[model samples]
Target: MRQPALITFAVLCLPFLLHSVAARAQPEPQSTGSDSDIAITDFSKPSSPGRTFAARTVINAPVQKLCGILLDYPEYPAFMPNTDNASVIQAADDFAIVNMTLKLPLGKIKKYRLRLEPRNTPQTCHLSWKQVPWEDLKADDTIADTSGYWHLVPHPANPARTVVDYFVYADPGYVPFGFRWIVDILSKESLPKTLESLRARAAELP
Candidate 1:
């Protein structure tokens, strides 16, 4: 009777012992590791101009390098998805004005001007842009209004990595009938693609 009871107890404890060992062998997660980059897109929040869109990711490159790539407005068409042309009309140490033309879904062309500012601190780098009026370009012909910012921070666990956050508020005033899908494409679907584009661009650079 004693032998049978001891065998039953051993069998019950074996699984728990194995699980404890497995847990102990597992490695601790890095603070800002690529595994923690979990991409998230939220459009549930309502805003005055358009729906709010926010997404985040981790890039393998350092923050400084990514900041440089973002400030290079003229090179946007080469890597930025749906961008047809980007012309910087004004440039200065603190800000830049860029005219961007985009080829949207169904072959529609949208053109707008944006005033971009790059802000930097010891801990983070940020690039914010808002649509501005161009005398020749009418509001009705282009996007109603748009504003967004990209925030970059260095990874705490790794010096060579960066965490990036992207936020967008866009109001495409009047989308042609049956082309309402463009709104979703711009906000929801494009978020991850935007991160991927930036990551690829950084990898391509020396």
Candidate 2:
């Protein structure tokens, strides 16, 4: 009787152990996609204090060329003015952890550490960041609630141009009801600049 009970217990525990091992063995994602198809779409709600912004552009280059340029972190400041510094702190087969410092016009510089995960293939990628409670700005005033995703879809009409889509959700910290205008203004101004800079960078690629 004890032997049978022990055998059943082992079977039940085997799956959980295997799952843990599989999670540990999984690799990080990579970014490798074409130009042209990268675009931003608007997904923000008016009533909420949160904001979302996206942009896309067509490039006169191949997907591999564009991916090479996109993955070059140290060169971000050269193309994007708002980005002061960006570097890959960790890298693996299917994912990369990147640290970025941005010079914002809102009187504060923002630093974010993003984890890039690949899905579907090297052609498609997703980047996500969780707000660190103590490290976040306006920690005492309000909580930092932000998440974003990047998708790379191939363009059937223009194979040379890849459609890159960006989606961001942000909750403005410590803003009064009437102060929601700040969120609107920031989203409108900053998102366009970011897209334009990205477009310019893609164009500059060899």
What's each prediction's TM-score? 0.78, 0.61
**Could you tell me the TM-score of candidate 2?**
0.61
Residue-wise C-alpha lDDT for candidate 1, range 176-197, written one tens digit per residue: 7898877776667777778889
Q: Could you give candidate 2's per-residue lDDT for residues 1-206 as a string of tens digits? A: 69999999999999999999998673322233644343445666788767777655554555555565556667878876567788877888676776776665556455666666554455544444444343444453433466665455556687676655555666656665665554554455555565567767777755
Regions of model 2 farther than 4 Å from truth: 1-41, 46-48, 120-143, 175-186
lDDT of 2: 0.60
Q: Please report, as a residue range, the 10-residue window in candidate 2 with the lowest summed lDDT.
A: 27-36
Which residue pairs overlap in candidate 1's backbone? none
C-alpha positional error of residue 17 in candidate 1 after TM-score superposition, expressed in Å: 44
Compared with the true structure, all predictions reach lDDT values of 0.82, 0.60
RMSD of 1: 12.1
